[model samples]
Target chain A: MDDYRELKPEDLVEDPAFRAWVYHGTGAEAWNEWVNEHPDHAQAADLARNILASVRGELDSFPGSEVKNRVQRILESLDAGRSGTHPADRSANHRDRRLWWQAAAAGLVLAAGLGALIYTRLPEAPAEKKSVAFVRAPGTSDQTHLEIVNDSESPRLVNLPDGSSVLLKRASGIRFPRQFAVAKREVELSGEAFFEVKKNPEHPFFVYAGQMVTRVIGTSFTIRSYQSDATAKIRVKTGKVSVWAAETVLTASQEPSTGIQELVLEPNQQAEFSRSDLKFALLENDRPEVAPIPIEQMSFEFRRTAVSDVFEAIRTAYQVDIRYDAGLLRRCSVTASLGDEPLTEKLNMICEVIGATYREKNGKIYIEAGGCE
Target chain B: MRPKLILQEDPVSPLWQLLCSGDKDAFGQITENCYKPLYHYGTKFTDDRELIKDCLQDLFLDIWEKRAHLSGVANPRPYLFQAFRNNLLRRTRRVSRFSEIGAEDELEFSSFSYEAEWIHRETEAGLEQKLQLVMKQLPKRQREALYLRYYENLTYEEIADVMGLRRQAVANYLQYGIQKLRDYWQQVVISLVLLLAS
Candidate 1:
């Protein structure tokens, strides 16, 4: 520490260490010890101390509530700029991610490959979300519905109280009770989400997305019901899924009107509902062309392999089931190297060789043939 | 008197994850939670509420647009502060708007004012007044560095980040700023004492 014995009041404040001592209440040991050890410099040290003390004071800042209101407006506008839907290509990419949403939700841990697309499914209605009410007494509510939204580019992992997990997509949201009720594990969703639900026969898992409600005993599936989307969809990756249009609730007094439809979906099946018509259809999922299959599993090189064996290999590679009787195909064999061909083309060639016909039913491919007599 | 509730600064919180993950509500909470501190910092530049608001709005929109690319950070408060400062400076530079009102630098940060709820002693009120005047006369960058250090309670490194200066530069600013305040206070006191004696 420099001797303050000769240093003036102005010179004292110029030292970074002295200023640190004054403001931060630190770096004063050497200076104070030096002053105490030498009484002659006490007067000058005292004068320097007085100058530093008088210069410090409190500064008033803007009111919190006013700035908070202004900032809220800014954030809302930011949300609208990016998530109020996007250009056609971007929307399609987000829309297509719906398939992966199911597979990923099924606890498969699939790759969220198309993460760059700005996926937005705005609710048609300007929701008077009770965000403020929730904030006002966050501590008071014992079972308040906890809402979570993945507004990021990639999927976010959400652990549910019931031991299930959700892989929420970007610009998507889910609201669930803080604790799953004993009766049911109910959660509401907006936009797109994939769920990997815990199996509890005593309590069924339910997801309410827009005008559609999906119930599962225990399984993984994806739901797409962006408020602004013209069509709402539900795709099952595994296990049985039961879905019903929420029109029944909207058209009160009409018990199960013809307008209300319920559909059951199995693995590799998708249910699409049009908002304008209030009607839904079950369709076989289009083959996941973009699904990342392992390089080694990409080729179908079967040499004198049983027809059943061929189907088994396809199932392992594509995660799609091909239903066929092993008994009828006991004598059937095939020798062909199918490389990079479309799934349908490969299936066609195999079915022709085995003298069997194939048809898609509920996302499953079924094969039938008169026993090889 | 400053309201404690309004002046509350957020600790490093989960708000960062929520914001980076594209949660609109998280964005809303952040605005409501950190706006006062941010506004307090912005007004140090200029008191025009509208301009500050506009700049803040633009900053937030930019954050949301690039949410996908943003790193999942734990504490983004400093980053927000830096962004607000940069935006305000950039906008003010374009028109030299606030400076036209006073002879202060175009990007002048508002120095400590005496009318504020000062915590100085009754005996040192006059000294405080003189100190305030000295503060106003300090260079803009020095004033900013002092504000970030003593006022915001930011570390030397954090102040450097906000001011876009090296840590050494920030240390020098504080040193020079305090020195100037002490010198001016002495001069004003000596002149006052002499006038009284006459």
Candidate 2:
């Protein structure tokens, strides 16, 4: 602290950027170091304090709605640029799925050899069974027709057949086969819907949303053909989906650039077709989408998956949160294959079984694990 | 004045996850949500709406592109404000761009009636006015860094991602920026204090 006392007034006058420099450049450690060393530099510290106060005042004045709206707009523009109409990599989706299945089978066989007892215990409590649950809101009945009509609300979700689900954002309704179409699975949706399709190579799932039709062999995808919005969009998560608007198909297409476009999506590559512009744009590809590969075959793993990361993944995948003390996240690790589990079930299983504390806060489930007890 | 509706909290927020996944939604959400603040931040530097919009758009896009590789983020809001600042710096760096604009030229812009709606008493209003004057002298990048870091409260990593620099570089920029501000403002404060005493 004495170091700052000896500093000349000129030293403070000459440097204005030190506040942010010490705070960000050297982390809390260096910032504290500077404050301790220069305790008597009251003028310097006061200036920094004033500037921070003003900035905080401004930010505090900023409305949260502005933040949400800004984020939405940026997403929309980027979505416009990197839509589905970009060039299609027809074979990439198929190639990856085949590779995953093969790897999973091989890993399982190897694991069985090493631990016979573990292999024998596997079927006792089925992982997939636990993952699957009836995620019904205060409903009419389990057998009654489940309809989520988002007339007043933004969007609602519904589970479709073949172990997949659909989130119908506001003003959307989807009807699926009671038990899934035997040969060709189909769903009729009027509005925006995100689909996580179950892989059934023998039975292709088809979505008849609007003037557009999306067909998938087996993949995870999100479709936003919201009835109100002019544009219809689709982003593939895993496997491949073939999408065709009114007149075009990616395969054996007739009219080139001018006509309505078609696209086949690879994992992480999105395909969006807007009816207004009647064109498409493909976004730059991201790293890769992680789907349900065999647990034994897991290679890309987070050493100790940060609780924050887990919370984010769950929220994104299911649009829910297991809220907890933000500070407690530093000590938590969640190791699990993020398969096709609904958001609530995953959180419930993770928090409840672990003896962690969790409850709904403003419609979000917050969980506290390590330090809670 | 800012819209009252802007303060309401969204319940089922998925945008944070989208940011983590480097999804395009994250970018879109920022553009939609932060347009007003970014626009205003730009206006603080230059009243040119088109320029502000352009800078913000590019900044948001770049943030989206680099999201996957972005590390050490506890939040995204501050990161975005930082991005807005960096974009302003890159654009303003072309000396000719600044030389062309005149202070007298009035640009028709959207009134932040939302801000005006909040009636401030005399002393608070005076402080705000003084603060604005202090902010005006800050170098473009430093102003941005300070705004995003302290105002929006972004982490160093987020600032680095937005500014296209390493963590240390962001620290240097911010530190240097803050140091300058402190010295510059001290004279203003001293004069005011002495005048009051006299």
- Per DockQ, the best of the predicted structures is 2
Q: Best candidate per TM-score, number?
A: 1
DockQ for candidate 1: 0.08
Taking the tens digit of each residue's C-alpha lDDT, what string does model 1 give over A154-203?
56656687657676665667767788766677776767776667777889
TM-score for model 2? 0.29
lDDT of 2 by residue, A1-373 (tens): 3352455433432233443332222132344345446445544444544444333222112234445654555556665774532223324232211111111112221111212222223455343221101111112122322434444333354556455656656445554546653456766555555666666788877775444567787656667664334466667666777776532111111112233356778766776666544456676655322222121122223345766776776555555545667685566676665453434445655565345767766757667567532
DockQ, 0 to 1 scale, candidate 2? 0.11
Residue A192 lDDT in model 1? Answer: 75
In candidate 1, stretches whose alpha carbon ends up further than 4 angstroms from where it belongs are: A1-61, A82-373, B1-10, B72-75, B97-104, B115-137, B183-198
